[model samples]
Target: MASKYPRRQFLGQLAALGAAVTTVPQYARAMESTLFAPAGEKSFVPVMITPFTSDLKIDYKGLSALTDLYLASGAKGLFANCLSSEMYYLSDEERLELVKHVVKHVNHKVSVVATGSFGNNLTAQAEFAKKMHQTGVDGVILITSHFASREESDDVMMTNIDKFLALTEGIPLGTYECPSPYKRILTPATFKHLIDSKRFIYHKDTTLDQAKIKVKLDLCRGTGLQFYDAHAPNGVFSLQNGAKGLSCIAGNLYPEIFSWLCENVNNPARSADVSWIQEEITRLDDVIGNGYSLNARYVLNKRGLNLQVVNRASKSPLTAEQIKISDDVYKTVLQWHERLGIKV
Candidate 1:
């Protein structure tokens, strides 16, 4: 007899292993050796922010501290060199170095995946992905916009992805519907095509539509692919519907809360708590993204992460109104910790 909870069972085996990261090629010994919570057991994977010094340089010290903070807050994996990290502002060399630094600092405690597709063409993107893979990340994520422009059709995007796969054969890859350039959400048919390819092991979904999310999750039923929804409002819905975990910008603010939500979203005993957190998550979603990673950095600093509010992506500093809003949200976050007995 088969289990009624098909998705759970499909992911359960890897969850039992506790730290099974992405299923990469045998040659990727670094990733293979790293530990990550499988899709069955939900985990938080933060779209990590880049910490900069007063001089606008990549602050390695702050970066290390930020890395430690995420792990301490229960992040099971790290999505470095991403939009949250201001990847577009960083040079190619900076991107690779940033990812390499994160991989070295993580020391295989958990898997790390970074954006590698920054080139203008499929071949350049493939070459960059290969180099990023060499940096010991478990997976290299390709930005969807980098494949095809907004003017292009899904078929054009698919063909380019196929070419990319061929060019960077044998490497573990993932896809990010990055909001930059443009957000090219994959249709169900296109999603099935990627699933059929079996080359992608992760997807950071920005589709934000619950119905679409459900369809995508259905496609991931028994595949090695794990879908991570980036929308904060869909936290409970996505988790309950079979998403592996979250990869939202909100995690950059309260990773512990996100991690807590993931661990308990499916707990029958905590169903009410789950619902309440979902409400809170939905309510604060806009406020959190107002000033974005900068607002997040401010909150993190108040929480004792000691990060400077410096940012290259959103060069403008937070407005007084934004700061006031973030401060209010920060107070609410503390209240949540106290109310739910989550660690401060």
Candidate 2:
């Protein structure tokens, strides 16, 4: 025989279950909080730097001109000292000088973000973040540790964030999560801890797994993390999955394509017109041998940017046949762009 329960007890149990179920949306909202635009805020679309060589050195003049093009093209922001810019190859002084150049050229027309990912030195990275803040740049983009073990990588990330937040006090920071076997993926719990701290203002979700990406979104909900999709090939799908914008290498060679996608993402009538554009961009990635960073540089060269396609200064170099393949792919993409009336 079951014991009799009062109506109040039944109601209390119902309320608890309802609260648990209702928390899902609340959690999602919390995770997504950081990504929201401020009141009356306009959308921002960021373009990456395409490091070009002039006389076998970094081309400051060409860099300035390219930045001016993006500004004139109505880009909302620019990122300096990134993989596209070959930041890893640059010395500390070169990186600082490049940031100064980027800020000077943009001339406050748009936000300028600089990469601050130094290898395995939280103190150095934090100090760099502080300097970038002092330089009056808008933000800093940081990568987690360079450890091969996941546990070690996680420890480095947690420690780095603590130090970075303490050092960079008032400035916004964007963390780039590009998963490699050497680095740890920021788990949902760790992401929540960071987001809840209210120190990190943006995140670039470059992890390839759709499920993991969703988890990122859910974990960061309500934390005011402006999430950007770094995987250029899936920009549209990423936007659909709650990413506020994109920060990508493909944006270097094909700003118009990304510009169109961002503009038409919310407009149903215009979406089909741009879906083809997205598809073409994705196809271009495949044609150039996907996942090779040099592909973007090659595409830019083919577009007559006069940028060198050399990635020798990078962490790795592409083979001669790889370069030929990249160039051939860019030509094909250009022909497709012409056919589609997409002006480069």
Candidate 3:
């Protein structure tokens, strides 16, 4: 179903969000208990992609439609304005507007988190995070790269992270090892630091290595932080070994498959089906990365969203072969929907 909140209500909420920036602690605490995910529950949180108009403006109508599709497809939450949303390419104001739109359109029906730490310094990051918190997001996600340089030691990163934590005070936080600006795969020690902070409620892991994932999961076993694997091929393994759920690029195309995998992967009776679907996801995952967000747009359009295949992150247009691959993958998703009895 579409958002019950109409355009008028959304604009009102956006204005409220702007004014509420001054009262962050009170508003954030009011929603924290309901917004934060409890430990041990599985989720499919799509790293949302921003849709653009032909003239390169934000296509808000398309964004709202996409959000509704995710909700209908069984997404447990939303990760908005992140790398998948082309955050780097978006202006700071545009990022806030995009997130506010999603949060209002979602009407607090599900948890929402957006990347907020964007400045060159920790103070700037904290200030922006507070502003983002006012947008009614469940939490503000900090990029791992923002805390440390590629050549810097973990200690340097920790020092910076500690400072940022102190600066932000009451705002809830999460971390993402975003691929751009170089991916900072968190070491177990660094991961432990975040868990121990009692501030981080989310962690999106990109270290496709399952052994490392297992160790980190053990560390965060009882911690409230929800660990999500960004690698789609490891979806089954990560979920089986106790990661909260998937937060991968593939969700941008067919979130229903991820939602179904999260719901049924642990069932003994569904083991065979699980294995088959995992293989399918792994193969399609590889294909989806070729043209990336553009190919993803193609698949979504094929599914009837009719989004303009425009992205600020990459100017590379999808090749003919890439479009063919996307078509095949769309058919595969349809087949999964039929076999799994997933209603579209």
Model 1, 252-301: lDDT tens digits are 88888999998999889989988998999999998787888789999998
Tell me each candidate's TM-score: 0.90, 0.76, 0.90
Off by over 4 Å in 1: 1-35
lDDT of 1 at 265: 92
Give all candidates' CA lDDT scores.
0.83, 0.61, 0.83
TM-score of candidate 3 relative to the true fold = 0.90
* TM-score computed on alpha carbons, candidate 2: 0.76
Model 2 CA deviation exceeding 4 Å by range: 1-47, 50-55, 146-156, 179-181, 289-298, 301-304, 311-344
Q: What lDDT score is found at residue 314 in candidate 2?
A: 49
RMSD of 3: 6.6
lDDT for model 3, please.
Answer: 0.83
Tally clashes: model 1: 1
